[model samples]
Target: MGEDRRKEIKYHLSEEKIDELLREAKDDRRKERLGFLKNLYYGDSIAEAADREGRSAATGGRWADAWNEGGLEGLMPSFGGGRPPKLDEDEQEQLVEMLREGQPWKSQEIRHLLKQEFDVEYHPDYLGKFLRELGLSYAKPRPKRPWRPENPEEILEERVDDALDEDDQPHNKRKGDDEEGWIVDDDICTDGGTVLGFFDASQPQPYDNSRRVWYVDDPHVERPLVKTEDSAVGFYAVNGTSVVQWKETEEKEQICEVLEAVREQNPGKRILLVLDKHGSHICEYTRKRAHQLGIDLVFLPSGSPHLNPIEQVWKYLKWTMAPIIVENEDEFHELVKDVFDQVTQRVSFAKSWCEKFLDFQKFP
Candidate 1:
């Protein structure tokens, strides 16, 4: 059994009964045991109950056994024998299943559910810890495209395979047994091999914006909004190297230029650029240029920015420069280039995409 796991438990008092006694009971010791019993009755582990009540697990066991053999009278200081738990094994399992269905639960909402569903009530503060002990926590929902295909994962795999465009079996690792493995692109792409890269464009303006900042009564920080935008088209290879090309405007011409730069950077290697289906990217001129340069373009599904890994890189770059003020477009471009170069020189960016879509081998 797991460390958190306990043998079968049985409880004597209903939650209403416990709460009523808790309100009227005069003895602090009786109240403490009642609180412990309340938590234990609502499916908290012995360790959780003991920690919440500031008692030892062994003592909780004794009290629980006392309650099992006795009820409300079992929590009395005189009780000698062991008692039982509030929930039977089957009821506990059913509550777990029910709780999981209506997620992102508020403390009061969950209390209502417990009371209505099982006639139980747990302290609000103790509920969070209790849920964690049972393997649940609050989490933000990821954005999903409502119109996405039913087989998005399958389509994703097919897209990656098409991008590889090699005598490829759908194998993640192409390098032979004797060859050295790389965490980042390193010198492998330069030596002639398929290069997987994420492509994107960004037009960062010279304005300060941040998600959070420490403040006293009120946040009163003023930001400068300079009238200049820095356009950049870029490629970030899974091998740890990135190529950022500064552009005057975001157009098909600049898109082609970035594609050419990627090919020039990874000469002789097949370049598979995963990018979005923007008009500038999907235009005839850009496609012609990419095909001529031996590059394959794989467009991410529309409305799904999270599917492309490079989006994170752009967010990171912006967040890195959020506080600083730049004098001009030149200064902003230089800052963007420096930060992008420093952060993208690692294979960490591609891990999420690799895990979700590919049968990737372990990195050496």
Candidate 2:
């Protein structure tokens, strides 16, 4: 490698000023230069600061010279006006193809690819724009399970609608899969219930579990959470009454207890409890108890957690509790229950579930 062209240059700005400039910096290159300066200000050599900033010692010397002559303005990148993307149409298409082959590509990875393959360098900000112009977008992808039923809405509608079956009795539903499938048993409750609700169990862990999350530009710190052995279960009643309880473990017996809780919520009516077919859920013991409790169990298609409305309730509970700190497991459990009660109270949680699956005029 060529020797880094560096010089021992005197500092012109204070560390605080460098920090201020970093905060105000909109462009990433400016931040990089500021970072190089930050290291240098903190008693690092020119070479050391440059290496820390992932730039060569030569570039560090140039930045120091610019800072010396121009101060804050000297550190700013002077990109020439009206520069065009280096890749031609065919070349751009080729780059897109390469991008398609990779699973996930960070901007830095793409930048390296561009420099290596096409002999062009684009800044991260400009790289995003260029890729967008090439019709690529950066976004979080929702998961899709291959085993998820294609006709989820239809399956749900059929389950709840009285007209769906010739006998008009609620049957134990089943889902087929590559493995031994979850199947609908013909001999189910003669009349499950008129009251409809959803049931699911979830584990709400501590904030320290996440590696990254969005935060304000200030102190992004999190306290070490008092880990809890508690997981929570909830019954989201579509008409607004819901029940939440913390569980030591989600067992088949717990399913029976939740069914009792839901039954108590609406004593006179039969209960329709829609949920996934977890190991604790679909066993002979749970089904027999649900039947005895006058609760009709509607199993969602395998791998289709989205079909259960209580899943959303769990998601909300987790989000609401993510920032909270609890000193003990009991405190954490209370925090979870408190938050769960507040969130699931609003019948709005199951509004989408109702809209998609129920034709209320007939379903009740």
Candidate 3:
């Protein structure tokens, strides 16, 4: 509103600096580049000056023209919309009360409530203005736990002890959210099955799907997907890949056999079998065999798939496999197996990809 205020905010750049920014404006970071120019001349708060210079206030060219014409005052906002203050203090208070209890209520929602309750119709855009006037603009909820123990020593010790007790009691053998012995990953499942990946001392890359998987048969075919109306009922296996019927119910013994196959490939190494806290993965038989084979089974904490490096790689694999278009379980198996084969053949590619990914977001 004041010329001095406008002048104070305007950017005062050297000729060379202005030219550099103008040149940089042509690049992809054009908005930022031109913003710097406008900020220099009008301190960035020159919507009116911008509007006067050009028909549309959104363009940078108009702001430049405003700089070329009248100085900083040209950019300041002017009274353009209309006269203000129709809803007195009482209406504002009512709006706040509605906002607190309303379910997903927008400006239009309030307008409807006004029509239904008090018989008033307001344009959606006007409702936005009303809300803003009431000081109810966008805001993030204050984080509840802004600061937590960086290393909760008790939790860490428990995790470490759990890791060490793989042979004794099996890591996290507790029954999960399976009332009927049914552990289901939240929907969006292509094939009704689950896959497992492992990490060991020899293999620095924690999860490479090509290495080995504890593929199992899943009976829940209702599609474990999160729906807007339905509470997401399955695990969002982050680093892990799609479930598959790579092995059958009759093949539990063979599942251990395949894991042993992986061990045979990587000999004399302390094994770390990383997987979700699933009912099937944690059993007395599986624990006994892992102990016998000198394998250390580890459980990822509940509601944490991001901790698994393999889940991330599996995402990449899924994205790559998306175009293949498999219709059935057999076709899905073939395609997934084909993907596994490709990843298996290119050991360096898998290793490099996992290593680079791990460094990007490291894991324990």
TM-score leaderboard ranking? 1, 2, 3
lDDT of 1 at 64: 65
The lDDT of model 2 is: 0.71
Candidate with more favorable, higher TM-score: 1 or 2: 1
Task: Give one digit per residue, the lDDT tens place, for model 1 in 62-103.
Answer: 556666776667558343445544453346556666777766
Clashes (candidate 2): 6
- Clash count in backbone of candidate 1: 14
How big is the RMSD of model 2? 16.7
Ranking of predictions according to lDDT: 2, 1, 3
lDDT for model 1, please: 0.69
Predictions in order: lDDT: 0.69, 0.71, 0.43
Report the alpha-carbon TM-score of model 3 versus the true structure: 0.40
Ten residues in sequence with the least summed lDDT for candidate 1: 177-186
Kindly report which residue stretches of model 3 are placed more than 4 angstroms away from their true locations once superposed. 1-81, 85-122, 125-245, 249-258, 325-332, 341-364
Candidate 3 lDDT over 1-364, as tens digits, reads 2332244343445656666756655443343434435454544544453443332233333344444454433422221245544443345456566766764465566777878765667777677765654445555554433333444334433553556332434333444422232221232121322222443111111112233323368522243222121110111122343222244332336445545554444444444456555454556555555555555566555544444555544454555554333345455555555665454332332353344322222133
Give the top-scoring candidate (TM-score): 1
Is 1 or 3 the stronger prediction by TM-score?
Answer: 1
